[model samples]
Target: MNPFELLGVGRDADEREIRRAYTAKLRHTRPDDDPEGFQRLHEAYQRLLQIRRHQANQQPPVTMAAPVAPPAEPRPASTPTSVIRAEPVFVPQRLDIDAFCSEAFGRAATGDNRMLSEWLQEQPAFWSFRAKADIGQQLVRRLYRDEPAMPTKCLHVLLNFFDLDHVHAGHDALALQRLSRRSQLAWELMPEHRQALAARMNMQRRPLERCLARLQRPYTWWRALAAGFTPNSAKVMPQFIRELAGPFIEDLPPSVSQEQIRFWTSVGHKNPVSGSQLLFMAGVLSMLSLVVMLGAAATTVFSSQTDMPRLALLGIGVAWACGLLWVALRYYFVLDEWLSRDEDEPARWPRLRLATVPLLLVIGLIPCLLLPLSRGMGFTFLLPALWLSLRRYWRRHDHEGFYVSPGIARIGLLIAIVALPISPSWVFAVATLLAWGDDLRRHRKVLQLAG
Candidate 1:
């Protein structure tokens, strides 16, 4: 089947258009009337959205052409299926060792040096990841000997080494204090390599900064066109960027400080091809789905003498139901994010978001809804909207690299306005409008608490 038809929008529809259609459709479905069907619609919508969003950003496309079955490497019969052993291989050394050790550890006595050498040898990541270069190792050995005049960078390296590679030594917490210490001892402990790493990261920040500026809405009239028409696009990025970048965006620090956010954002934004690809594909599929639904709806309205429109609506709704079911099956992984709260913050949003789920489900199942529209049409419109509202409210604060800012109230208001006049359509549209509006209110309450 054409992916476009699957999403319920027109071909070549932009992200906003696709989003509008999706929200409108899912809002119509009553969740309790057919929970299983509602779930399928959600899944299809999620996957398609991810795909299109990546495409819009000029990222690489992800194809699920054949279920992407994992490579069937032959395994020993006795090996356990669940055992996991991951080892990082192929990481490059970034620090200069000769200067680090000579400057930092040269001041120490032989006995003190000997103790530090043993400690360095005990770090597991060094051995497992093979991150130890000869120069870095030599510097590490000297630091064990109490090297003098060690740079603060050298101290930072040791701190990272201890924090990331040494757990059993019980020095993890000490590393934090060591980093924060405002003394000569701390400065001497810093390694030259860490300084280099920081410098390199600083250098890498410019491109991400540029991309951020380019992607921000309202910076340029017809911004997408401006981005698309840029000349000499030989270096144009691919579309699969979000597959690589979404997690990093989620990981960015939530501080309001511009400098801090910039530093974190630099570390997160990578290749944009995946992101572009997701956006494009999602836009296309959703648009196509919208076209199909609209065409079917129009046909039903014009062909009032026959039950063809009803049957077509039923068909569209079934497809949507299947989509929601797909989402439900993968709900565990996605749903868990909604429950996660920042360790420093009181996690009010997560609590309220969870509390609203049952309410959504109940509101999702007003009997008046299904009586007017068949389950299939309901699935197409209602399920996607519900999931989008839930996801938006849950992850409202995450917006660094991936484009997660969806106007929930705007979408709700649009649905409500469009829903009022229609007869049979009112049931599906009204239900969706209510769910989205409720979600928006809940989101506002949490935002107030956060403020």
Candidate 2:
């Protein structure tokens, strides 16, 4: 198609007419409104300019009629009447590279964003091609999944610095979509969190939500087991961890349970990474430990029995011994992550290793180990580890009425757990019951207020 027709100009249309027509058409064909129409308009604008330049170069210079020099001077050389002036080019203006990032990032947390807005005003290139998809994509990468992202108010100025926010097309326009357009892309607080923040910050009644979703899976045996074995959960776990993967425990609202907060962000984050593979294996081995002890007891209980199945017991002992490497590997991963927590990438975690699983195995097996050696020594040996786990549980629940069973009651449960050879299952049972109580208390309190 003719450049002249594209811009709705005559072939002889000058640069001003073409530019005017292009600008007029541009208003009707914004990138966000119709990307294809905008593209065609932009192309027409460029093509018309190019054609004009080519014609200017090819046109003979307008020359004055040579003066009839009456023998005063040799025939005067032809002189051009009009000089072909080059098109005025608007060079993209940019901020100082050194201060560019420092200034923008410094305002990330603050309300005053005049530095960015004012700077953007000075830079005209973003309107042309500077702030296109490539830069927009890079900016998206710089955003945090958990930590408060750049202020949305300031983000608008930055994204729109080059009117390209509106004129960009296709993938480019999508990349540069206004963060303000989607509440999630802005500073959305979680439901419970939003209320807490507004009360704390003295915000108006308007909804205050945009912060990232909390990544939480309260510890449950079923969750741990399923996460380890399910193919879809395995893949999704990693992705969820990545999206809400930062350590923002400090940023949590006061309304949230700190004890539960600690679990979700710290131990909970590690769950998917640990993959519970070792835990699963430990369960199988520990179950065997329970079974063999039960079988031997059954024979003894029913009749004045043959000796305890020493051979079978010894074989299980061997299996348990062999499984030490499995246990060690699990510890290796958990300890590695524990030590590396300060430095490792938040999104990356060791597969098939878990801290609690190993802890449970060790706690459970202590009693089993001593069972053969002495009539009651294993339970005695297991006392200290169970106490320590319980004490830690209480400390974490400092948030509210997290259960810390009285020592006597726990000891009673411990004896039962030991007698049954269920080991860590008791630990899980107590925690689960405690968590249920905490939730019940929380909901009941809310219901009382409503009533």
The numbered model that scores best in lDDT is 2
Q: 1-451 in candidate 2: lDDT tens per residue?
A: 5556777888778876776676557546667778766666676676667767877899653332344646644454785455542344334355354354445555643545677665544433343443444555454444322233354566666556433345542334533333332322223344533454456445443522311222333455554443333324334433433343234344433333344333323333433334355544455567667678888889888978677788568868976887786666556555444422312224243232213333544555555556465524444434433443444344434565555447645765766667456554445445434433433343465436434
Score candidate 2 by lDDT: 0.48
Per candidate, the number of residue pairs that clash is 96, 9
**Pairs of residues at least 3 apart in sequence or in different chains that clash in candidate 2:** 126-162, 127-162, 187-210, 188-209, 188-210, 188-211, 189-209, 189-210, 189-211
**How close is every model to the real structure, measured as TM-score?**
0.20, 0.26
Winning model by TM-score: 2
Instruction: Put down candidate 1 lDDT per residue, 181-265, tens digits, no spaces.
Output: 3223333113333243235344344443454344332322233223333322213222112321233333221211233233323
